[model samples]
Target: MRYLFLLFMLFTFQLNAQVVADDFEGFGTIYSWYGDDCIVDANFLNPYQQGINVSNTVLEYHDIGGQYANVQFDIDTTYDLTMNNSFSLNVYVPSSGLTGSEINQISLKLQDKNIEFPWMTQSEIVKPIVLDQWQTITFDFENDFYINLDSNSLPPIERTDFNRVVIQVNGENNDDEVLAYLDDVLYFDTVSNNPIYDNLVWFDEFDGNGPVDASKWFKQTQLIAGDSWANGELQHYTNRQDNSFLDNGSLKIVAKGETYNDQDVTKDYTSARLNSKFAFQYGRVEVRAKLPSIAGTWPAIWLLGKNINEDGGYWDAAGFGNTSWPLCGEIDIMEPNVAKNQILATWHWDNGSGYQINSNSVPSTNANTSQNWHIYTLEWSEDTMKIYMDDTLVNQMDSVNPFNQEYYILLNVAMGGSLGGDIQPGFNQDAMEIDYVRVYQETPLSVQHFEKNKVSFYPNPVQNKLHIDTHQFANTNTKVQITDLSGRIISKKQYAENGDTLIYNTSALNVGVYFMTLSFDNGINQTFKFIKQ
Candidate 1:
């Protein structure tokens, strides 16, 4: 047995040694990527300039009254890239038509094979000018995050091979007059040698036809107070395309103030809410998203109990499990209050019984939570729950109180709620975009026996109370304790002279895995695994 154990240890170490590189460095030549024209060959693009009244050059400076300009390039053919790895690109925009308040739109995109556009941060890649000369534009694909690329959404990429690249003018802003310039678009290598994460189990690239996958998600459409949400929330959610759309390899949940269905009442708000029906007990959950920045916007990524309705009550109704306001646990993995530009991770739970339970919150370490896209994640185990912002563990719960139940995922941009209060006047209507939500499960490790005694328990996976027979050690002083997998002690009791058997009332325990330990005065200990139903 010792020899076999040593062999297993050696194999585990070898597996951990195999590191996969995430960062990639691209070659420095632009000519190496172009086929014939000075134009860079890419996966997809729509430089509107070729349409009628637009410029194709990277250097142009006239906004046509009703005209526009754009440039498109495909990166798929430029490098052999994997969604599991990171890649970088270089872009040069020597000058852009920027007056005091005029924000000219220039963008970087990771397009699907169809050449549809999903613009990156600032909605317009900003280029600070030095002089009137050509400036070296450096775009690191890995450094500057774009639309999320998942296992299935990333277009086929190759070395010096690309599908498309595009640059466009904001026809709504420019009087068909502002001109933008670009040059030296290149792809390079990344720096990741070993991934901190690889245990992905499920995800939706939102690449197929339809309103997300119905089997994986459910859409809610009960307009609250003339809007689909309450708390004076701004966006009026609808199934209509104007408020929500699935195009260009993304699921766009736009919040606008347009007339659709039969409501002519205008206050400026339209959006969409998508919920996950697949409940999970304990695992890692992550979402890569670009949040909306409107003043009244209350965007959030959170979780809800799966059996919330088992008690015969609606979500917001009165006494339902712990849902009794602060008791019925709420895990807010990511929430951006807009005006603050800060991200918050919080937890709310009912302390066994109360009008309001205890709650905690922590600000994220990253700056400008709503300006750029970011990956927000939560790690939940048997005894503890942790929240991670961009690879940093910020907040954690380890009291072993009562958070060991199944929970489903929820993502939405509420206008107003108990948290955001209500939408104020003059709020912009923009979408809270989501790239994708992914789940991963870690491999369980083998157990090593510590100490043992003759004390025994029977009929595990019990439906009612449990009984422990201490007939084997009649004179030993034994203390009993029950703890969950996360190492949170749930219940503890002491026993005197061990004669026949002792009974434990477990009517209040939830259905899940648990551990029971019995310690004697002589330092002897015995542990047993059990389940409660």
Candidate 2:
């Protein structure tokens, strides 16, 4: 019976095995498999069909929005296509200049017999197409599939049925100019429907034997007297090798108590700060580094906005009175004060009510961070922002609003801030060494199915407290039983409600290994292993 049930579930998955549309061999011909099904429709636009003209640049093909035509096609399959499926094609554009609102460029739509405006997220305007290039464009239709001027806000399982797929050449673009060319169109199964962080973006591991990649990083070279640039912060910015160096396979940002002045203070300490030349919207950002030691010194790895105050430009804004700093928004991924060896994850935003800080902190036992390296991370997304020390989720943003716009990562050592005022008078030089920084997006896991099974918790290596997040299975009648490793029941408790979140007070339990079992009404059994220190 168990094997039969598993088979039924797998069959119900409905794996996508059909190609909804395609024009391989560079638009030379359209062939259908399973015999004698060669067909063409007037609604589909094929530039190579001699009805439209396209120009090729050194990079890819190009066409004006209003001037070009649209593309369309219909498959024998109806609108029942749902999650785990995808639509894909390749497009090559030369120019990197385009407006964000131009819908005539690219669009995908699904409609009933009416074809009225549907809810979906259309493609944003991008740079003009380059010449003689191949740009592969894959559209994941599994996640509520979107179309031009429409937003897909439906759940995955709810929006799987549709009747049409429409691609267009013009939208919100006044310049009805030339038409764009396309080729090699195919749709298949996708692991997930997320477009931005689907685990295929390009990135470097920073493990080479030389300097950091010049194409990815840009160094800041500025020395303002008092080195004050908001946060009422202290420390002079320098480009010296001693202050910041890439040696023995790591990047170092050093802070010291020496000074020089161009028009301000001439004597103090110096350090280096590095910023990326590129900007990222959302991803998992991780930094592995060793903190520096100095009484008043502060070391940090964080991110900043790209265009907070863009009128004066990038370099000028870091010089004070040029642009209001934190007002634009700040994501402090990791900040360790000299007074403590621990790291904190926090967010600062203006809510019509000045800048407020929301943060999470944890203890450090690695002997004054300056001695060994630790991995600090900031997991950012449209709905959540989190901080992690190594593998532990230390602090998370309370409201999930800190990451709505574009933000660039930063790794620097500041002498003082609102928290760094404790910098002692007799301070010399110190350094923060970083192995590398990496970013990623989490794979979406199925929560609905995971909650249907029995849940259990186990004995743990603990000296303080143990809690179970029973809220996961809120609709089932469940009971938890705790026992010694030798099959001795210590306690049995029932929840008031299905998922009434219960806490097992460990105040009286002795420090030792134990076992826990959870039995569900469906006859499913679950167990876990834990420890008590």
Candidate 3:
């Protein structure tokens, strides 16, 4: 009977995939929709959005009258929540979006269609959205499946047969003035609609190398032109084997405190900077590296516009002929401050007026960034740039400025600069070790396909439930288990040996970290760690 129920659930799930119920594309003017306390703001320009999409009319919530005042709207189409159970929408929250002393969180009221009156269940979003940016708010019904009711006369809210979506901005029973912007409401299946990026434009494992690959990478010495690398940097870059080398499938850039004179330019510290010969316009990049522990060591994995040769990565006796920096865009992927547990992503460009630097920094409150290996990622398209560390979104930005041009990769370590401050006198030598650097472009699948395409799960610090899907797991015994860090089993489930998709509920677990493992009959086991916050 358990297997039978699982089979039926999978069957029903496969039948109800995601279709665009309503995009709110032409909501007020061309199309018809009903909303209270909100109207289409046609003239207001949206500074941030997807690349292909322009600043269209967004449903704006004006001065939401008073405490508990809200702008409510409903999607009139019938949606089968059993399959397409996630409701996603984009909300623009200005710096002053949340006004007055109100406990954070907005309430989403979903109603089921009924003959007389629909059954309403309200869910509160406790996760606060970042301000002064456009954020896609996704509500997975399976995660926080709580139903807050004022009157208990109606039966429990049903999840399998829901057809309507009613949302109240700032509706967690809190009273306050709220102003917000809403757009692109969608219902989607988390697994079937999984996005993939498979094109491997460039990658360097740095394995079996004496010197860095000259065809793909070149060393940048500050003495190439003059050692005037900006930001009060204190490092003399060298292309010698003492500064950079590969061993055991890892590239190490050693930073030494005592440096000798070279080509009339001398510094107390010597390090290495390698710039890529390959330049790409738009793509996703992932770099796995363990950082240096010494104080005042600024290890960076970054990019610069190939056209801008100010730093002189590939300079000749004639020098690179380009305009200059600020005319050329710069994207800082991972720049971990010296001796700090924080990382920052910065964008520098000239906006036809003046130079601007927009940096988004995220700090680790628990541990130092130099403690272990981490995967730093940057997803860049035409107009959008998002950064992540170990799959946690550091921040996102939207702009089509000078960053629209092609940029090449750069890796280096600088000591005692603006961000890297206070070098310890006793510091001698430390190295930033890198495992691999992989660059991928938009495609139909993921780069993980290079590993035979194992099971995939997403939204890694999973909020409530973990969705797992495997394309090739055939008629074999399969069991997935969730366990704590101490190897204690929290929950386990045995699925039918044939299906490619399954789910594990983590809502009932504690608010700590846990591990999930998938066991197959072919003696293969895959385990991944996730947080249930």
**lDDT (tens digit, per residue) of candidate 2 on 216-272:** 665564543233544655666665667766677777677877765633555466776
Model 2 residue 486 lDDT?
Answer: 41
Give per-model TM-scores.
0.43, 0.44, 0.53
**Model 1 C-alpha lDDT per residue in residues 219-316, reported as the tens digit of each score:** 65655344334455645555565655566666667666554453554445566666675666667898887776656667788886654532222232
**Per-residue lDDT of model 3, residues 411-524, tens digit only:** 888888887788879779888888999998866344344234355665444556666667546676678787553445778887765676666777798655455767777676
Give stretches of model 2 more than 4 Å off. Answer: 1-212, 223-227, 310-327, 366-368, 398-402, 441-533
What overall lDDT goes with each candidate model?
A: 0.50, 0.52, 0.64
RMSD of each: 24.3, 23.2, 16.2
Give me the candidate number with maximum TM-score: 3
Give the lDDT of residue 396 in candidate 3. Answer: 59
After TM-score superposition, the amount by which residue 338's alpha carbon in candidate 2 deviates from its true location, in angstroms, is 4.1
Query: Weakest 10 consecutive residues, lDDT, candidate 1?
Result: 1-10
**What lDDT is reached at residue 362 by model 3?**
69
Which candidate number would show the highest lDDT if scored against the true structure?
3
